[model samples]
Target: MTSARRTVHGTTIGIIVLDTAFERLPGDIAHAETWPFPVQFRVVRGVRPADVIEGDASLALAAFHEAIDDLVSLGARAITTSCGFLAAVQDELTRYSPVPFFASALLQIPLIERSLPAGRRVGLVVSDANALQERHFRNVGAEPGLPIAELPADGPIRANMRDNAQQVDRAAQERDALETVERLLAAHPDVGAIVLECANLPPYSDAIARRFGLPVYDIVTLVTWLHNALVPPRYRV
Candidate 1:
């Protein structure tokens, strides 16, 4: 007698969600309706935003592993997370996943670096500069010396994410984002493009791009590229 094997039929991507209670705008990865293709989501219950930003691997690794098992069993061709800050434990997650896993949008940093001209840089907008350390960059194979800016500590944007507020002020968030980008460009005038390190920021990507006149990269762009690779479209040429 042959043993039965479990399989998921159509889903190509699985997303491990953090235990958050904030409003997820359209472009944010946590919003299930954001993806065009069908996806499976498993909330790593108890894994909060602070845990992803500053907690030790031991705090979240077990939940991540369990989520990977669930997603893989469901036939997910690739796995990704809803939080970009999880880049801190990416190596551990990759070690546990049987399929391709993109733990953070920061994973695209190295590829972005390759596109830059000599002396030009990529500006990084993160949730908190204090939480993003040297190891986070190293985990994603990104070089050091990348200029970074953080969301204002006292702004509505940070309030929504860090405090897990029930409401988000889009107008206020855009104001803070635009101001931050301007400061970043002023400080690092040679920045060729901007990379948003927080997955929740993509909803405002266009606004930032219009204000700064630079390309913006975020989790949506990275995951879309990865999804294309996992399930390439067939064209009758």
Candidate 2:
């Protein structure tokens, strides 16, 4: 009788992607070239970006499970999502996934908090403040009322992204991101580090880091760190 074991290969990271038609640039986590190591991408069909961000996660949970199963079948050792808002579903997804699962970049908040001095908080830059909830923080071990700044939903950046416009106004998006960061700092001057809560924000990370001279954490940083653990480099004599 032939053995029924699953055949696994080289890919180490499995990215759970949203069902969106937007253009993903090089820095975007969903972009293949974004990572140095090989990765497998599984798009959770029917789970729109807003569905994860603005709606309850019960409906999207099944989509995540199905995607994770496909990625594992393709030999992914670890899993992560393309949206920080998915942190709301982190517990459920992690429970369903057999491999190590990091559902959102917001999972880095608690660790980043420890690095800051007393009374200094991590400032968050997210796609929408009104949509971010206590459950999103609780699932990721983050405290409720974490200082946050939301990108204007009515602005060109959100409009372009939400509509999946063919041409993204990079300059406009950058301006809005920067303005939000500035506002956050103005409100919370004790913010020691800034975290970009939206996966789409890493494209502007360097600019934000340069303008503020603070450590900026995003999905790229979180996933790269997770990838290192999932596939540590082999030492050759």
* True-structure RMSD, every candidate: 1.8, 2.0
TM-score of each: 0.94, 0.94
lDDT tens string, model 2, 1-237?
Answer: 973356666788989889888787778888888888888888888888888777887687877888999988888888998999989888888899999999787989999999998998999998989988889899999998888999998877678779987777788888988999999999999999999988988988999999999999999999889887766789999
Work out candidate 2's RMSD over C-alphas. Answer: 2.0
Mark the 10 consecutive residues where model 1 has the least summed lDDT: 2-11
Task: Give the per-residue Cα lDDT of candidate 1 at 81.
Answer: 90
Clashing residue pairs in candidate 1 (N, C-alpha, C atoms within 3 angstroms): none
In Å, residue 122's CA in model 2 sits off its true spot by 0.6
Model 1: lDDT of residue 25: 82
TM-score of 2: 0.94
